[model samples]
Target: MSTTTPDRSYEALSYEWGQPPNGDFQIHLNNGHSVDITENLAAALRDLRHQDPSLAPRPLWADGICINQKDMEERQDQVAMMSDIYRQATRVITYMGTESDNSTGAIAAMELYCEWWNNNGASSRVEMGSFTHEETIAIQKLLSRGWKLLLMCGRRTLAHWSLLSDFVVHIFDGDLKEGGFLLLPQSSHGTDTRAECIYQLALLRHKVQGRTISEECKLSWLLCDFQVFAATQISDKVYSLMSVATDVNIPIDYARSARSVYLDAAKKILANADDFTILHHSFPSQGQYLPSWVPDWSKWHYGTEFVVRCGHLCPSGSTRPSVRVGELENKIDLKGLLVGTVTFLGTPINDHYQRSSNAGERAQWVQQELESIKAHLNGTDPSLLMAECLVGADVFLDVRQRSTIGEGFVAHMKQPEAIIDDVERSLVNSFVTAVRRRSRYSRLAVISGDYVANVPRGTMKGDWVGMMNGGKHLYVLRKTSTEGEFTYVGISYVSGLMQGEILASDSPSEGRWLTLV
Candidate 1:
């Protein structure tokens, strides 16, 4: 029964242990000892028992049944080995509970989509007209269920079940397609069918390129992606991912507070990783006593968009991190240059767009925002600057497209009620897409030197803009009462300075040590 036993063959169960019911269900072990279990786990066990009579009574590893949760030491030891246990198992069975809300139809639709993907190949586009209305609804349901399951189990493990092992199954009947649809679910979180389709196509392309799921399983990436996943014990947020993440080696100790665990993970990642992307992952803490530099994984910050594509914008280009832990308990010293200071602030882009009720209102708001940005321009073209700042200088949109989008904004502002031409409307659509790309927590700010930036919400006019060594983006720092120290505000996206212009002009030796609390 030891996970380290290489010769043993057993299936590992991956599932969400839902809230404990009003009463517990008992399961008698081979030793004649009855153990109380949660209703969700009991249902999973029952459904698993009914699968393939020939394969019935097979050796299985269910965390609830196998691990003694009452014993802290045993739980710690077993949790530490979870990654290897699932990886070495003959198969990983993902039980998504019994079918409900036409789950059978959903599974069938998933199979059909996978068939279409395989036939058309990842390079081909998915036309919405190809699927019927019923199929679309079913697919949406399947996507939603899969996402909920993923929120509990880390994406790397679920990716294995959906893509590699092909073991995602519902309790009643119908099998999920091998190489399952790995799309984002339709939810109130702002993702839609078009976005889901794009994500699916991207995953298919990666699969076609023969990339292994393990290749993408970095600790930093896992933490950022799964921070919103639910965990009864807050510390489990970091502990549960230890098995699949490659770059972390924190000791598993349930005795530590969640804050302590999160702080340790943050420090370890900063010290180990080559880039400072981890710094940007830290959001405003929610009543937790932790350093501003460390991410509070337990708190879910609303409208926090994943900025994976922003890696290319190296404001402090090619500069390796020169950092050291300060004498103070929670302070760290990072060497970097002061970019500028915040002077003017605009409405948070997402919030402003959300307030509008119709396309006309939305267009009017965009025009007003663009005019405000234009007024701040010292000498640079407003259209070019606004285009770059809105999208964080994303490479996905080329220079020409960005200019057209900016010009469209100007044209719209000039004639708010006039009908737009085909090309202009397409450009306007691009502008809307760019707005969605920005994080809702971000706002438009004009820093010193008349430099505009997409700064974190609540950034004050006097906060300092800094370019930390090894960081991909500029960060805002609030000066502390202590003369030499500063508290970390949040990440900022300053236009014009993102392409290593500042670092190229200044010598590395001139950089000062910024002590962050």
Candidate 2:
């Protein structure tokens, strides 16, 4: 009956608990008693029971059943042991909810599509003629679920699930994908771990990013990848992640505030890795009221639109970035850098709701957003701002070249007085091509003092964008007026302006660095 024997062979279920139905849903216990569970978990058990009839009443571990929900101490202990629980299991069964209206057909179509993709290669347009009427409908159903968006976007998966576990069922049965496919039933859990499906399902469509790079720590990866998942208890957000985390020594006290746990985790992660990778991955906290420096994993969207590539934003040819942490505390101090006052700020381009799925719609939004930036620039020459917009973040080839500049640019040192005509035109052409291409996933802009550049989602007009000596991307700084210090906004991938007046010339008179806390 004890699931924590450490040597027991059992199946661990990974599923989202959907909203409960009108009546009680109960699970039978060993003592000839039954306990209530979410309707979603009950549904999963029924399917599991039917799935392997041969193994009648197979030994399994379901969080809702195994952990005593009412006992805080037991819940914390079990939650901390989840990673080991999953890893030790003979199999980790992901319960995607049962088939809905057209789910069976949708799943079959997806399987066939996977087979075709495995045999052939990546193609944007699906060969609808190759499928039957039902298959077409299935594909449409899947597409309607934004499966297409999952294919195109950058995502991260649970490292343990991606690398350690072996899945039992092949929902999208086909050749092995790059990482592997994890077909989950539709549930609220999908909201947090849905990106995990991108690894399992979307691998068939596009080449998954970061498949090659070695992850430094599991906690960092979890914070970066699984920021969107929510937990009932705020502290569970940190506690539940203990299993897969390489550093488990961090305190897991349920009594402590989530902010304290997060701050402690950040401090530990920074100690292991000197680079500022975690800072960039952090998004603004969602209602948790944590410090700006602590990443609120509760939020779904990242701070910026651009994917913070590994070893990115560090100065050229440098493997290790210049970073230092507090001696015995959570505070981090960035070496002295420049600061600029907010002269002008633009309206938000992408808010929580207004994000457009269609490329054309996003381009239209970008155009309108640029027009708004133009209004704020007043009478200044629009060329520089336009060039920055053109060289927007995630522009692939352009970003690669712009991010690799080592010796700095002569034209940038003489900005306002001198401009690189050829580079400016190239950026202009890039911007025009982006608009025409109509692929507006990561291109975002914020305006300040006759300047516009690609910024993350939450970037505001008054935020200070400055250069750190070894940082590859511009560090967005927020002023703490009362404390007379600054906090990090996510790193900015402002194209073309990488070496401009904001970061260039080392003008001691023009820039000042306040202690970052």
| Model 2 ranges with Cα > 4 A deviation | 2-8, 20-23, 50-56, 117-215, 302-307, 310-312, 315-332, 346-395, 398-452, 456-462, 494-513
Q: Where is model 1 more than 4 Å wrong at Cα?
A: 5-7, 51-56, 113-140, 146-188, 191-218, 244-247, 285-287, 300-305, 352-357, 378-381, 398-423
For residues 391-475, write the lDDT of model 1, one tens digit per residue.
Answer: 6666446777754655755554434567778777667656655665564677787888888788888788899999888788889
Best by TM-score: 1
**TM-score between model 1 and native:** 0.82
* C-alpha RMSD for every candidate: 6.3, 9.6
Q: After superposition, how far is residue 342 of candidate 1 from its true place, in Å?
A: 1.2
Q: After superposition, how far is residue 503 of candidate 1 from its true place, in Å?
A: 2.9
lDDT of 2 by residue, 1-517 (tens): 6766766578887776667434488977678998779987887777766455576668879988888777878877787777778768887776656565465665545555555655675443343355566654543344334332221111122223222111212222223332122233334332213333444343322332444436433676666655545565767666777765765457667888777787788777765654555676665544556556667765555222234552323322232344466673546655545444344444443331121234344445545655666666674444444444433433433545555222121122232334448675344334443332222223345445445565544556577766664455666777776464677666665544454434354542333334566
Give lDDT for model 2. 0.52
